[model samples]
Target: MTKFNKIVPDDFNVPMYVNGEFFILRPLSPVYSNLDYDAVIASKEILGDIFSDNWPEGINSREDNLRYILEDYQDFQDRIGFSYIILDDEESICIGCVYIFPSLYEGSDVAIYYWFNVKFAGTYLTVKIENFIRSWVVEFWGIKKPAYPGRDIPWSEWLTRPRKKFTD
Candidate 1:
């Protein structure tokens, strides 16, 4: 039998660099009021089907966004799950988000989900970021085989099928 260890949120060091760019992996907080809401709304059009059920609605105002951020922050603090705001090297821009939480799948303990601005969708940076995330979770956090539940689409089709070479 294999020994199972739980991942504690404090084990992670925030604002780590990956792929030659500085990026932060801290949980969402109210202090992130500087988020570019307009850009997030704009990306929805480009996100297409991926944005369907995963994205939150009713973020028409900063207050709404803050509320969601606060909730996510609390979740991280409680070690229930983590929702990180992916920031730029200067930590001045919010380019995207990465969520790590308990798996909804029947036999998995953890799962991951991520998204970036449309501008990064087809770039090598996206692939690097994704690979960095997987390696980080396994090596640093000890989640050897994290799950990616296909809530938005079928897992086999989304991950294994021949698709656009966005992330290699």
Candidate 2:
């Protein structure tokens, strides 16, 4: 397994343009629980056939979502790397979240998982959000390159369950 870099507060909020709107990024916290879940579920509904199949479930309840966030925070603290919350300034709400994990196979590689709500599903917004997400990764993770060429998975091809491991 790849050792995770301990995530510490950098004392600054990351910025991104979400469909011409500006959003501030902060470390995922207990307060982000409901917003994260609602946004993701909303995205799943709105995006319809344009969503990730590997998205984890069980976020329909606030209590359950809180537990999930806490676990994720602990995981990040323990070495899962960085996870962040995207907050809307005008509306004062969180509309999305993303998690970055160190690659177990290579120290120089990282993986990102993200979800946004349906309210932000317009094509322009989608492109902006993707740009925002990747930019944050590049800046925070100390990646010298924009993205690992020839190693990124296509969104369409990633819509299936991962291969199962078997042992006797």
Q: Over 4 Å off in model 2, which ranges?
A: 1-21, 46-53, 105-108, 144-152, 155-168
**Cα lDDT tens digits for candidate 1, 14-130:** 433333345665566776655746446667666444543546566777777777778777767667667877777777777677777765444445767777767666677767777
For candidate 2, give the lDDT of residue 154.
Answer: 54
Q: Point to the candidate with the largest TM-score.
A: 1
Q: Which ten residues in a row have the lowest lDDT in candidate 2?
A: 159-168
TM-score of 2: 0.65
For residue 21, model 1's alpha carbon misses the true position, in angstroms, by 3.4
The RMSD (Cα, Å) of candidate 1 is 8.4
| Clashes by residue pair, model 2 | 43-118
